[model samples]
Target: MGIKSALSKPFASFVVKKINKWKYHAVEAQQKVFKTLISSAQDTAFGKDHHFSTIKNYEDFKKQVPVVDYEGLRKYIDRVVEGEENVLWKGKPLYFAKTSGTTSGVKYIPISKESMPEHIKAARNALLTYIHETGRADFVDGKMIFLQGSPEMDKKGGIYFGRLSGIVAHHVPGYLQKNRLPGYDTNCIEDWETKVDAIVEETIHEDMRLISGIPPWCQMYFDRLSAKAGGKKIKDIFQNFNLFVYGGVNYEPYRAKIEETIGRRVDSIETYPASEGFIAYQDSQTEKGLLLLADAGIFYEFIPTEEYFNESPTRLSLGEIELDKNYAIVLNTSAGLWGYSIGDTVKFISKNPYKILVTGRIKHYISAFGEHVIGEEVEYALLTVAKEEGLEVTEFTVAPQVNPEEGELPYHEWFVEFVKAPADMEEFRLKVDQQLQKKNIYYSDLIEGKVLQPLKISMLQPHAFINMMKAEGKLGGQNKVPRLTNDRDLADKLQKYLL
Candidate 1:
C-alpha cells in the first residue's frame, strides 16, 4: 500500500473515536448557537419591515413569524434575486445556489457571503466527524469525484455563474480542484446527453476513492462505469472506493441496487443537505442512521406529526425531542430564514440530540383511493414483507395508477426489482398486498372490494425502470425516480414502462 493508504485505517479509527467523545460538547455548542440565532431573529431581523418587532419568547416568535413554507418565501426570494434590501441577506450575496426544489419549479437561494462560513463549517464538521471516527485526514488521498449538476453556465469576465455544481467546482479546495470529475463546472442544467457523456468520460480514466452525490446520480455513474468496464463486474471498475457519501433523499429505495451494481458491500454515509443547510449525517461504521449536526449554525424544532398542519404544531425544543416520533422539521438558520419549514420529516434514533433517522419527504406521499400513505409507512411495509417472504428486494417504487379500461380505481402499483426472483411470485405479491392492506386500514377496505380492487404488482426487468427514467430525462446526475407519484400524468408515464 502507498504511504497515505497505509495510514488511512488507523487515522480513520482515531477520528471516529474522537468525534464520538466530543458528541456532548457538540450538542452544547448547538444549544448556544440556536439561542443566539433565535435572539437575533427576534430582536433585529423578523418583521423589521413592519412595526411588529417584539417577538421575545417562543410563543411570541411563533405567532409573529407564521410558519413560512417555501411557497411563502418564493415572492421574497424573487425580490432577493432582484436586489431587494433586507429581504434575503444583510448585504450583497457572493453567489446564488441555484437548486431544483421538490415542489417549486426552481429557485435561486441567495447564499450570503457571511453565511458561507456556516456552510463551510457544517461541511467541515461532517468531514471532521468522519475523520474523528476514522482517524485518517488523508483517507481520500486519491481522486475525489463529485457527481453533481450542470457545469456550463453564462460566463461573465471569464467566470462561470452556473448552479450549485458550478459554485463548488470553482471554489473547491485548490489541491482537490483537479481531482473533481469532468464537467463539474459545466452547466448540466442544459443538455442531459452532453452532461451524461461528460460524466462517462470523466470517470473512465481515474480510480475514484471517494464519491459524493444523490442516489440516482450515483447510480448513473455506476451504470456508466459498468459499461466502461466491458461487462467486467462493478468491482473491476474500482474495488478501491472505500467510501460513498450520499444525501438529498432517502437511500432505502436505492440501497440494495447500488450494492448489487457495485458488486460489493460499500461503506456508505448518508447526509441531510438542503439549501437551508447541511443538517445531519450518518457514521460510516454504524450505517444505521444520521447524526444531526447540532454545531451547524441552526436551531432545529420538531413538531409532532399528529399536530402538523394544525392551527398550531406542538414544537419540541432540540433538547426535548424524542426517539421514534415522527415530526415535521422546522429550522432557524444563519442563512436568515427564521422558523422556515424545510418540508421534510425525521424520527429520532437516540436522545443525545445528535442522531436521527430521515423518515421521508413531506410532500412525497402515496394515497390510493383516499388512503394517505407516506414514505415511512411504505418503507416499513416493504421491509416487513421482504423479511417475511425471505426475499431480497433490490429496488422499488410505488405509484397510484387509475386504469379506467380495467374498471379499476386509483390503486397503488408497486414496481419491485428483486435480487433473486421468488419461486412463486404470485404468492409473494399476494402476501405483500395483504400486508400492505393490513398496515393501512384504508387500503385494507379497498382490498375488500367495497372501494377498490386488490393492490397490483409488476416485476420489472433488471434496471429497466431506472433506464426508463433515464429515457424520460429524469435519470442523469441529481435526478431521481419519483418514489411515490400522486400526479396522474407521472403515474401514466410510469405505467407505460411497467413490466
Candidate 2:
C-alpha cells in the first residue's frame, strides 16, 4: 500500500472521533461560539455601535443587532475596504471573498484569520468522515481535481480579494498538494472552457480518484473528458476515480447525467460551503442530509423562510430550530459578520446532531402569482416525475409566465433540457405539474381556483442552460442557474434556446 493511503485510515479515524465529540455537544459548541464572537469583538466599531458589551444573551443580541444583508452592512464594509481596522471585526480581515451581487454590483465578504481555518477543516473533515465510515483510504494516493475559479487574486486595501474558491486554493494542505490537479498554470486559466480543456489534457492519462466541484461544472468537465476519450465513460479513463466531492448546490438533479457520463454509480459527499462560511458536510453515506457545522467558527440563526421579509421576523438560534421547517439562515461569524443574512434557506432534517438540507435560496424563488414556489419544491416535483417517466434531465429552471394569449391564464413555465425527448412530453409535463401541486399548497390552490393554469414545460435544446450561463459569463466556479426566479429575466433570455 502507498504510504499516504496507509496513514489515511488512522488519520481519518482520529478526525472523525474529534468531530463526533463536538457534534454530540452541538448546542454547547454553538453557545460558546456566540459568546466568543460577542466578547472578542466587543471593542470593535460595530460592536460599540450595537452596544455589544451590554448584551448578555440571545435576546439582548436580537435587540442590539438588526439582521441585515450586504446593503445594510455596506457602510461598515466600505470602511473596511478602505483598510479601516476594528471596523467590523477585531482587526482588518485577512481576505475579501469577492462575489457577484444582485442589487450591489460586486460584494467583498470578509474572511478573518480565525474563521478561514474552518473552511479548510470542514472540507478535510468531509473526506475524513467518508473514509472513517467506509474504511476506504486508497483514494488518498490518487490524484484529485477540484474544478474551481482562477487562483489569481488582486489586492484590495491590503486584503487579498478574489472568488472564495480562488482564495481557498491558496490554503490547500501540503500533504494533498502532490495529489492535486491540474497544475497551477492550468488552474489559473481565466476562461472556463479553456480551463476544462487544459484540465482534460493534463489529467487524462493520470491516475485520478476523486473529482470535486459544483455539480454542473463537474458535469462539463466529465463531458469534455468523455469527448477527449472518444465517447468513453469517465471511469474507463480513470479507473480509480471512486469519490466525488461537491458543494454549492444539490447533486440529485445532476446525479443521473453525472453517473451516465462516468458509466457507473460513484460515491459522493455533499457539502454546504458559502463565502460566509463552510456550513455543513455529509458525514455518513447513509445519512439523508449534511451534518450542520455547529462547532465551526459560525453561530447560526434561522428565520422561518415565510417570515424572512416580514417586519421584525422571529430569528431562532441553533438550539431553538425545529425539524422540517424551512428557515432563512443568518450568520454571526468569527469573520465579524453580525446578524448577517446570507440568503440561503435550510430545513433541519435531523435534530440531535443538527443535520440540515439546504432547501432553497431566500432570494431565488417565484411568487409572481403569490403561489410562492421555491427551489426545493420545483426540484422535487420535476425529479420525482422524471424518475417515474424514466426521463433524464440535464438542467432546468422555472419562471412565471405572467401574460399569455387572450383566453389563456398565466402559468409557471419550466424550461427543461432533457437528455432525450420523452415518449409523451405532455404526459411527463402533467405528472411534473401534478407533483409540483402536491409539494406546494398555494400553487395547487392557484391552479384549482383557475387563477393560474397547470404548469407548462418548455423543452430546451441541448446545452441550452450551459450556453446561457456562458453568455452571462457565469459558466463556472460556484455559479448556478437559479431553479426558480420571480422575474422573467432568465426565462426570457432562455426563450431563444427553446426546442
Candidate 3:
C-alpha cells in the first residue's frame, strides 16, 4: 500500500471510534462541551460581565446571556481589533476570519487558539470518517486539489485577517501538504480567474485524485480544465479521481452539472463549516443529513425560525430539539462568541444521531408584501421543476418586484442561469410557480387574491451569474449568489444581463 493509504487506514479507524462514541452519547457530550466552554471563558471580560462565575447550568447561561448577532458583538470584536487582551476570550485571538455580512461592510470573526484546533480536527474527522465508512483509502494515493481562497493573509492591528479558506489552507498538515496541488505561489494569486488559470496549468497533467471546494467555483475549474484538455471529462484527465468534497452551498443544483463534467458517478462528502465555527459533516454515507459535531469546541442553541425575529424567543438546547423543525442556530464557541446567532436556519432530520440539514438563512428571504418565501422553499421549487424538465440550473436568485409604476402587481422575480435550458420556457415557469405556491401558503394567497401577480422569469445568458460574481469581486471560494432577496439590489444588477 502507498504511504498515505497506510497512514489513512489507522487514522480512519481512530476517527470512527470517536464518532461512534459521540453518536451514542450525543446529549452527554454536548452538555460536557458546554460546561467546558463556560469554565474556560469564565474569567474573561464578557464572562465576568455576564456573571459566568455564578452561571451553574444551561438555564442560567441562557438567562444571563442574550442571543446576539454580529452587530450585537461588534463592541467586543472592536476591542479585540484594538489589541485588548481577554476582551472576549482568555487572550487575544490568533486571527480574524473575514466574511460577508448583511448590514456591516465585513464581519471579522475571532478565531482563538483554543477554537482553531476544532476547525482542523473536524475537517480531518470528516475525511477520515468518509474513508472509514466507504473503504476509500486509495483516494489518498494521489494528489488532492482544494480550490481555496488566497493563502496570503493581510495583517490587521497585529493579527492576521483573511477568508476562512485562506487561513485553513495556511495550516494544512505537513504530511498532506506534500500531496496537495497548485504550488503555494499559484494559490496566493488574488484574482480568481488568474488563479484558476494557474491551477489548471499546474494540475492538468498530475495524477489528481480528489477535488474539494464550493460547487460553483469548482465547476469553473472543471470547465477550464475540460477546455484545456480538448473537452475531456475530468475523469478522463484524472483517471483515479474518486471523491469530491463540497460545502458552502447546497450541492443539489450543481450535482447534475458536475457529474456531467466528470462523465461518471463519484462519491461526494458535504460539510457545514462557517466563519463562526465548524458545525456538522456527513459522517455516514447512507444518511441524508450531516451529523452535528456535538463534542467539538462549540456550544450550540436553537431558536425556532418563526420565533427568532420576536423580541423574546425560546432557545432550545441539543436535548430539546425535535425532528423536522426549522430553527435558527445560535452558537457559543471557544472562539469567544457568546450566544451569537449565526443567522442560518437548520432542520433536524434525525434526533437519535443528531443530524441536520441547513434550511436557509434567517435574513435571506422575501417577505416584502407579507408573502414570506424562504431560500429553502424557492430552491425546492426550482430543483423540482428542473428535475421534472431534465434541465440543469447553473445559478439563480429571486427578488421582489414591488413597483406598481411598472404596470404590474408586485411579484417574486426569478433570475435564472441555466446550463441546460428547458425546451419549453412557459412550462418551466408554470411548474415553478405551482410548486412554490404549494410550498408556501402565504405566497399562494397573494397570487390568488391578486395582491401579487404570478412569479416572473428573467432568463440569464450562460455564465451571467459567474460574470456578475466576478464584477462584484466575489467570484470564487465560499461566496455564492444569495438565493432570495427582499429588495432588487442584486436583481437590478443582474437584470442588465438578461437574455
What local lDDT score does residue 60 receive in model 3, on the 0 to 100 scale? 99
lDDT of 2 by residue, 56-145 (tens): 999999999999999999999999999999999998999999998879889999999999999999999999989899988889999999
Candidate ordering by lDDT (highest first) = 2, 3, 1
Question: Against the unseen true structure, what C-alpha lDDT does each candidate score?
Answer: 0.67, 0.92, 0.90
The better candidate by lDDT, 1 or 3, is: 3
Candidate topping TM-score: 2
Candidate maximizing lDDT:
2
CA deviation > 4 Å runs, candidate 3: 404-407
Q: Compare candidates 1 and 2 on TM-score and give the better one.
A: 2
Clashing pairs in 2: none
| Each prediction's TM-score versus the true structure | 0.85, 0.99, 0.97
In model 2, how many backbone clashes occur?
0
Each candidate: RMSD: 3.9, 0.8, 1.4
lDDT of 3 by residue, 1-499 (tens): 6988988988899878977888868999989989898898888999999999998999999899999999999998999988888878998899999987758778899998988888998898999998888888887888999999878888777999998988998778988888998898998998889999999999999989989999989999999999999999999999999899989889998999999999998999999999889999998888799999998888899999889889989999999998988899999998999999988999999978899998889989999988789988999999998988788998899999888556678878999989888888887898899999999999999999999988888999989999898898788877888899998899989977999
Per-residue CA lDDT of model 1 for 67-157, tens digit only, reads: 7776777776666666655554454456667667657877666565556665655554566567655655553567767667665556332
